[model samples]
Target: MNILKKVILIDDDQINNFVCESIIKNERFAEEVQSFEWAENALDYLKNTAVQQPEAFPDLIFLDINMPGMDGWSFIEEYKQIPEEVTKNCCLFMLSSAVDRKDIISAKSLKEVKDFFSKPLSPEILSFIKEEFICS
Candidate 1:
C-alpha cells in the first residue's frame, strides 16, 4: 500500500480520534496522524503549515460534522479561503456520526469534500480510500 505522508482527524470525540488514529497507524495508511478536538484549531494548523511548510500539510483530512465550536460545514467554508496550491493535493472527507440523509447530500455536494463516511475509521474503509483516492 502507498502510505500517505500525513493525515488529520478533526472531531470532538477524543475516543473516536484515538480509535481512528490507531486504525490508521495499524493499517500503515499514514506516516503521521494528528487529531484535533476543535475544527478551528485544525484550520489554524492548516493555514500556518500551508504557508510555512506545505509539505507538512495533511494529505487527508477526516472531518466530523458535529463539533462544538466549528462544525465540519463551517470548517469547509473557512478551508475554501486557503490558497488553492496548498489545498489542491489535500483530500478532505467527512467522517461524521450523523445519520441524516441531508447531511450526506450536503457533504457530497461540496467540491472540497471527496467523500462522506460514518464515524470510526475502519481498515476496510481505509483500504478503499487508499485504492480509490490516494493510489489513483
Candidate 2:
C-alpha cells in the first residue's frame, strides 16, 4: 500500500514535468516517476507500446488538463482502452491549474479521479501519502 512507490506523469508542458520530476526525485516520494511530454506516448505506453510487462503500474498519476492533441479529457476517455486490471491499480489525481468550477465538478464526479489539486505538487502531499498508505 505504499502510495507513491511508483508514479507516472502525463503532461505536455516541459516546465511542469521538469518541476514535478525534480520534486519527486529530490524528495524521494516515489521509487521512480516516468514522465511523458506527450499524452499519446503515455497512452500508447499504457496500452502496449512501451513496457512489455507493464512494470510501470503507477500507484498514482499526475495528469494535466491542457495538452496539444490528447488533452486530459481525451486521455481519460481513451484510458478505457486499458484493461481493467491496470486501470484498477492506478489512482488518478487531476493535477492541473484549471480553476473552472465546471472542471472541478467534472473531476470530482469522475470515478477514476481520486482527487483534484492545483499545480505545484508539494512534498507535504507526498508525505501524507507515505504516512497514509506506505507506513500504514
- Say which candidate scores most in lDDT: 1
Pairs with steric clashes in candidate 2 = none
State the C-alpha lDDT per candidate.
0.93, 0.80
lDDT of 2 by residue, 1-136 (tens): 3236678898888888888988888887777788998889888877882246665667788899888988999999888777777678777888888899899899879888877878888888677656754566
Query: What's model 1's overall lDDT?
Result: 0.93
Q: Give one digit per residue, the lDDT tens place, for model 1 in 1-136.
A: 5389899999999999999999999998888999999999999999999899987778999999998989999999999999989899999999999999999999999999999999778999998898899889
After superposition, candidate 2 runs with Cα above 4 Å error: 1-3, 49-51, 131-136
Candidate 1: TM-score? 0.97
Cα-based TM-score, every candidate: 0.97, 0.86
What is the total number of backbone clashes in candidate 1? 0
